[model samples]
Target: MGFKSKRKIKTNFVSAANKKLRLAWDRKHRQLTVSDWRKWVFSGKTRVNMGGSDSESFYWSDVPGTNRPHQVRPQVQGISDGVMVWGCISGDRPGYSTAIIDGAIDSNKYVEILKTSLMQTLE
Candidate 1:
């Protein structure tokens, strides 16, 4: 057998309603021209993991031996340490981003980010 160990790919579960909404959104925007798209700024937020990920690892070896330092992953003490960041970009240029200094972003924080980063990007 020519099988090798591999890590499982993680994926998010999309609900049927979410799928329908995405399809509808695509249909609505499918007719938009390049200039129309250029006028749009796509924005999103993600967590930048400061610590190592909590995922399984695999290695190949002909004989069983002690695990090397590189083979072992560090275990974080608490919740995965990471900082949340928000950014936006247009068709022509990248935009500014800000780290969530205090906590998770709320509606107010989102508006503030839009007022600062998004406004600067548009200008």
Candidate 2:
């Protein structure tokens, strides 16, 4: 036995915590399958008078003009994929970067997490 030092479980715990943080930022992190983003034809009435009316097929970015203050709208012209991730994170640290340490989001890891969470709810 050529063991150098004692195995620290706290160190392992901290490592796991860091991974959970990466997961939070990856909630909207999805790979773009195509080189360019998809764009809608957008050929219709330029201005739509909602007039406080509710519609199922409406988006905030649909408004072409930027008049609202503190309202930085995304150019929906570039339709990007926004996937949902059921992971935890420390906080909104910006940059939205996720680190999948040693292929963390593999099929096995996903299945294991699902099983564990499901088991908890059953109890």
Best model per TM-score: 1
lDDT of 1 by residue, 35-118 (tens): 999999999998777775545566666666777776677765866478889998899999999899677999999999999999
Residue pairs whose backbone atoms clash in candidate 2: none
Q: Residues 27-114, candidate 2, lDDT per residue (tens digit)? A: 6445533332232111111122223222323235556777665353333443332332333322222112222233226677556654
What is the alpha-carbon lDDT for the whole of candidate 2? 0.39
Candidate 1: stretches off by over 4 Å: 1-5, 59-67, 75-80
Q: lDDT values of the candidates?
A: 0.86, 0.39
How many clashes in each structure?
Answer: 0, 0
> Lowest-lDDT window of 10 residues in candidate 1?
52-61
lDDT of 1 at 120: 96
